[model samples]
Target: MFFTDSRLHFFRPLVGKYREVVVECVRLLYQKLYTDLTGYGQSHGRDFVIDVFVEAIARAPLLDEEVGAPEGRFKDARALAGFILNNLLDNGWMERRLDEATLQSHYGFTRMGRGFAQPFVESGKLEYRSRNRNTRNTRNSLQAFAEKGEVYDLLDALEYSERIISDFADTIAELEERRLQLVREVESRQLIEQAADQFFDFIDTVFKPDLEVRLSADSVEKYRDQIASLIRQVRRRRKYGEGEHAELLWQTVMEMRLRKLLPGRVVEGQSLLENIVHTIEERLQSACDIMLPALRRALNSFTARADIIIRQLSYLHRQADEPLLDACSRLREMSPDNQEQALQRMGQVLAGVRSGWPASEQFVLRSRNRRRTVRATLANAPGLDRDAQKAQFISQVLDQAFHVSSQHIRAYVSDKLITQGRVYSKHLAVQDARQLLALAHVVSLAGERLDNGFEILIHPARSDSAGLQVFEASNCGDGYFDSRENFELELVDRQRAS
Candidate 1:
């Protein structure tokens, strides 16, 4: 179908033996005639186009046989340029028109010709970084649709999502192509400099500017949740909202003829809005689930191959310069018997080498002295005092006898609450020092996993005498449990727990 078009006949010149001349001519024509701020500025007259073609043909290198032989049929740049220009005009690559005011013919490229020539012109220039903003544009478009509730905004989001997918796919393919090209170069030429240059060129032009940005700030995962939320909100409102919203959505769909954009026949009952939303959702899902992983793998594979090549090159480069490394490489390449012989020879060459303290130098050594021991007799031991022994017994009893724990506190509270449904801190009966200690620990243990079937509520105690009940207890002296806060213990109903 593509070859059936008559306009594509211009491709013949590009594939012919004199393609170099034709390519150069097209590049010059684009640069001179169309590279203007206001795209393809006013067309130039026939003489000007001829001059551009002549310059390109003169600069281009052609085979001596093609230029000087009988079949060439051209002897000078002017004649060759004229023939090429006529071929282009007749083949639909260039157009000629007469201006009424000037009464002369003007020349310019046709639309298809200009489109095809764009890549050639760009490839000749240096591209430092990618200028794509599809990821950011997709996010902004969806956000706009969410805020404005406009059908056009949703359409823009869908378009941007598709563009991002295409861009990622192109990036992956280009990376793989570059990797294969680099591998071929390394295999054919085995030149480290050229390979390193191309590798860094890729990093500067592609990896850092495009892939790195996509993996970080421009990543789909970064904006996936927000985009998904907005998409759902828009779909819900457009699909199920009241009459006014639905009418407006349908009007937009009809006006834009969005139904025609669907790939296949619409289902029996599906609506335009649903189809668009589904398509957009599918594109985003493919990007996240398929494209991202493929991109990561492609990048990792390229880098790993480049790394291995560069490391191998570097090692070879070192082997060529360093004697020791060269020897090791030679030894590795030799047979087992030869390798053993070489190593033995190397050992014999270095067998007498020794550098440390000289044998003539001597130093004296000192001996260590033994430690003295002393023994005590039973007759010299002093008798134990009864007072000290009694004081020690009291100290041990005070330290170990009155230690209270959470179980003890729980038991005390349970005993107090046994007579009633609840009890307050003021009513707690402290019978001895142990009960006083247990009461002190109840507040600390309240927040822990006591597993006690009760809850503690702490509140400020009232200043009235009835609220400030006192408890009498004794350790080795008189003591009272006083506090400004009161705690209430209520039984946890086991019926609800069950």
Candidate 2:
């Protein structure tokens, strides 16, 4: 707690005056509490500050193993804490407050304490964590807005979608601009080599990490789905003219016009919702400008330069080649005959560039004008006439259902039955209520009615002790057993004459 009384004074020092102490204090706190739980001094060893130092060093063995324990540094843990606390407290980096309920002094970080500790934390020696944006939730919200065909919902979806596309373009543009800055900063080849470390660090630590998250396949797929769904929903509602809030928006706009405040008024005869859709579509379509061939060429050139430098570094670490080996052999045998051989070997080593192997040239060509084959043409084609088709199809279905011999002569029914209702001398048997209904459709289509005395039967299928029922029976020979299905249907009704 701070007081405005004249006796109360807040002493804040420049970070440079006590930066090292601040860093040490924070490191000790993390090492003792979080990283190195064993670093705390025991009650008996509290006065032995050397043991505390030893414990602290032991906890962070990898980074602080070289730090030796200091002897005769402090009286006890209480005294040591007081000394460190006073320095931190004096600098306004920490605060000590008396709790009203507990009546005990509580030590906690002040604004300065958190501000000073950030650098140590960001050093990445203590901990590391990566957080990605919750793009899925954001996209889902936008999709919901699009699906709900209200004026405000459509407006919200439009704004959200536009932001996503614009943000993508902005990030890529920023990276392109940063890459250009290297030219002004780098003067010579040595400078370029020096800048390479910083450049690659920025790419790896900042640029690439961010871009990877933003362009993750899952996020991209969800984003595309959301955008496509929004587009479809918007167009669908517009076509149907069935949004709930359109009337409300129209009234609001009219009110604005009455007041001479022409908000969202367009010259074209389009509602505010329709204009918003058009604007969103145009922005999204143009968002791909960053990925166009022209910009891609520039990006490729930058990558090519970086690759050349990387390859050059690899070449420096490479082993001696055959030409160098030959040169060494000639030099070792210093004879007159070896002089010409040494010259030839030296020439081979100096002629660094070589033609690529001829066998490596392989590629497949795809014509730009190649047409896509229509594989679904069969589904789209018109089929045989509906009337004759329905009769033939129903007859075949009945044959499969009954499994009866053709000697009954019911199988000889013609397609003419589908076109004209006729009084037949014979009856058609249907196995179940479902089949009876199916057969009724065809009979109804023929505009024929059943005779006054018609028989229709339905019964449960035969079931064993296991409760397993046989729903179908097949005819093996001239004789087929009586069907024992859920329902046996004898077609009793037909279409009446029109």
Top lDDT prediction, candidate number: 1
Q: Whose TM-score is greatest here? A: 1
What are the per-residue Cα lDDT tens digits for candidate 1 across 152-198? Answer: 77688789889879888888998899888888777754565687798
For the record, the alpha-carbon RMSD of candidate 2 to the native fold, in angstroms, is: 26.8
Clashing pairs in 2: 431-488, 431-489, 448-494, 448-495
Worst 10 contiguous positions by lDDT, candidate 2: 61-70
User: TM-scores of the models, in the given order?
Assistant: 0.57, 0.33
The Cα error of candidate 1 at residue 124, in Å, is: 3.5
lDDT of 1 at 124: 75
